[model samples]
Target: MTDWITTPVEPRLLRGALDVERTAHGILPHRLPAWARKQFPDPYLAMVEAQPSGVRLALRTRATAIELDVLPTKTVYQGAPVPPDGVYDLVVDGKLTGRASVPGGNTHTIDMATWSAVTRPGPMGTARFAALPAGEKDVEIWLPQTEITELIALRTDAPVATAPRHGRRVWLHHGSSISHGSTAESPTATWPALAAARGGVELINLGFGGNALLDPFTARAMRDTPADLISLKVGINLANADLMRLRGFSPAVHGFLDTLREGHPTTPLLVVSPVLCPIQEDTPGPVAPDFDAPKLRFRALSDPSDRTSGRLTLTLIRDELSRIITQRSADDPNLHYLDGRSLYGEPDFAELPLPDQLHPDPAGHRRIGERFADWAFGDDGPFAVSGG
Candidate 1:
């Protein structure tokens, strides 16, 4: 029998994380930098950023079998059914070869009525995968897209090393829950991930669930991160969270762009408006979950008439983003805009409606990914050949 070798999970073996924290349990990958985390230390932000949406361990090895120890913390809404365990994707030589899920882990339960949460800790678990063709190959362990995962240990039947460079462009994306892959089948099945695969670029997803409200710190993070391509899927969370009005929204958008330009003056930046969410299209938001339904559903709580004032709506946001992008284009040719409806609109809703009047189903994610690949990464797209 071959003796199993335990390897230290180093930073070089990981990809897509802006920072890695050494916790008492293990090394935790963080999408947001330390400064940003300190500035806006919202529990929700901490959860989503540490959830490792597009984060993965990239390494080279000839191991026939491997095991990873992790402490996964899954979020749960009270009264609503608990979601299934998150999946771990194993990709070898650029192909998804295996998938697994850790059996037991902590559960963070949230009470919707009071908007409070309590975490019930559980024992650590391991994800194991076996059987390889042979010879050294690049291996990527895509962590759970929604769960906060603390990587504890890595043991393999053979030695492991750093992954070889593939010279792929780094794509940095920031958005809301949809971009965070709500209801998507797996980590790689997310719209951004699928698009990245098609475009042949490295993905750094900053799509925090329910937290894409034009925060200056978030924009600063995007500015500081080294990325060949960058995109911002704006509006959904902004409207739903009802963080600001039209007056503040426009300036916030400008400030966000200003920060990005500070770090990358000429990088191809795409600002995407919100997709067609019927509930928020005409209605002002501050959306709330409707627990009356069997499955979780959300309804727009703000008044539609408030639009007459300075309230923010999906339509208003789209128009503002379009006008801003059009004006900014004169000075910055690299800056561009895409109506998110082009990715998912009424036509899409007719065929593939959002499951809970909020997030798209797996099919919708795939469709969005396919269309985005053609529109943004195709021959005539912005990232055509020399994206950098």
Candidate 2:
């Protein structure tokens, strides 16, 4: 580490976070603004937001080696194996060039039965990338999506400067864990990240695991952010949590769109429904976690004939989303819809089944990313470049 230039990430060199807080460790990034965070004191939202899904350090340097020291907090469920260390992806000159992970960090242990969690402090660790291609080039170190990281220090063999303005269009996407890189191999491999790369746009992912319940604060955050393309991947968390019924779902969606329009009046706003999850497609959930299975599995605890009789079927929800998008598109032409299954439908599932029966596995993430890039960023797609 000799002769390495060490300093915290400059705000201008950071992308995708709404705010940065200088702390004892270093810089802590927030995807949501302080005002929006105050509206929800729920621990679920707190933890979800703290994990930097789309946040990254973007800079230009001739440095052939880079190292970032961070304190990552990994969540470990009681009785389950300790979660793997979070991955840091290095992209050099727009291509994924290397990957590294910290060896040790804090652990947030969760008791599934009691739904309680306790965090044990651990040591700071380093993610080092060496022998980057020679020349002054753009480099991005994508933070781990599933870990809550407190950046401690940045050390590069040569001085780095903020990357100049990349004229690529910005895409702001909000969704559930799928969009958050759940089960993905690395940050850059996540569907949204992959699609953004293929689409040649900058990404600001607002996907929070199990927390994309159409919250007004989230909508407000999306509304306030500047973006050329915007998308809402709704319906998954709403049904997974059994949070609301069709009675409340439609209006909440409308209100959410209304808020987004307040800021991005005509931004290409794409609304996506839930992808194909056999367990949840026909059944509603407050899905119970089943540990005895070979792999972590889930069971839909409640039947459709239950209180949520006709309202929450994934199919029904998709239909409702389609109807809403169709009805709204009459006046708002930029409003578009994408069937979630188009991204991960049955045929594709037969090939790459979801490892957990809920979240897609790493391969599935790549498939979804490829399809999305073709469907959403390709010709005639919602976010397609005019001359591309």
Candidate 3:
């Protein structure tokens, strides 16, 4: 065996994460800040955000071979086929050059039928990349977007150092699991990552799965985070969680915007409603899983008649979001709104059906990412860069 140089993972070598917690076993990257994490202390958020969605290790090295020791906590839904192995995307000099994944780690199994769960421990595994070009180069190994990865060690044939920042515009985004890359094939394949790549911007994704409820702490986190462009994908989580009514959603959105404006007074801000979800389009929610079906599926349980009583629904949420942005944009020219339907509407659905009646599949993720890039970064788009 060739001698290898092992190095401790450092904060300066990480990108797309807000913070990194050095744990007893390894380094855990977090999408949310400590204060925000402390504020929302739900186990679900803690677990999901700690999965390091949209996070990556960036470095400059001449190493022809490298290895990363990681402990990945993978989730398994009871009765559902095992999820595909978590994938690590390797990008070199801004180009996707490779991919890798370790064999095993921790497992959390949940039974959607009974709402019960169990956790089982597993051993750390290593991901190895060899035969890389021989020369100093920028390299980024994007952590698995859907797995809670505890980075244990990094080893290479040569020394490694933090990659120099490219001075790209930073794009900060917040949303639900869709933005968190629910069904994406790999970390960089997540919609936000894909859009950031196409838009030529640095990304900091705050897409907490099932937790993007427009909480004040989330808004505060966004307000404090520096960014050249920002976007918020709202409504679906609120409705699915049955967290609020229309009466509260409007003000909540306004407050969220108000807080963000406090820190990003003139930064281009975009508000995008939920994409096409037929199950919740006209119907209200508190979506429930359909266990009877052979494959896992979801159905909204709230009554459509609840609309008259001020309950939230996709249609209502979209209308309210459009109105709020139109009213606020009159004085805040940097504020803009894009109907989520424009990104994935009925027509798109007819073309690419949502497998679970909720989250989009990988192809759907690509479609959303492409459309988002064209809409937000295209010429005449609000966030369009000069000559981009």
Find the candidate with the highest lDDT and give its number: 1
lDDT of each: 0.90, 0.88, 0.90
What lDDT is reached at residue 248 by model 2? Answer: 90
Global lDDT of model 2: 0.88
Per-candidate RMSD, Å? 1.1, 1.5, 1.5
| Candidate No. with top TM-score | 1
Q: Which stretches of model 1 miss by more than 4 angstroms? A: none
Shift of residue 213 alpha carbon in model 1, Å: 0.7
RMSD of 2: 1.5
CA lDDT of 8 in candidate 2? 61
- For model 2, what is the alpha-carbon lDDT of residue 6? 87
* Model 2 regions more than 4 Å off: 307-310
Candidates ranked, most accurate by lDDT first: 1, 3, 2
lDDT of 1 by residue, 1-388 (tens): 7589999887888998999999999899999999899998578888888889899999899998899999999989999888999999999998999999997888999898787889999989999998865888999999989999999999998899988768998999999888888689999999999999999999999999988999999999999999989999999888898888899999999999999999999999999999999999989888998978888999998778778667888998999999999999999999999999999999899999998999999999999988998899988787766542
The ten-residue window of minimal lDDT in model 2 covers 304-313
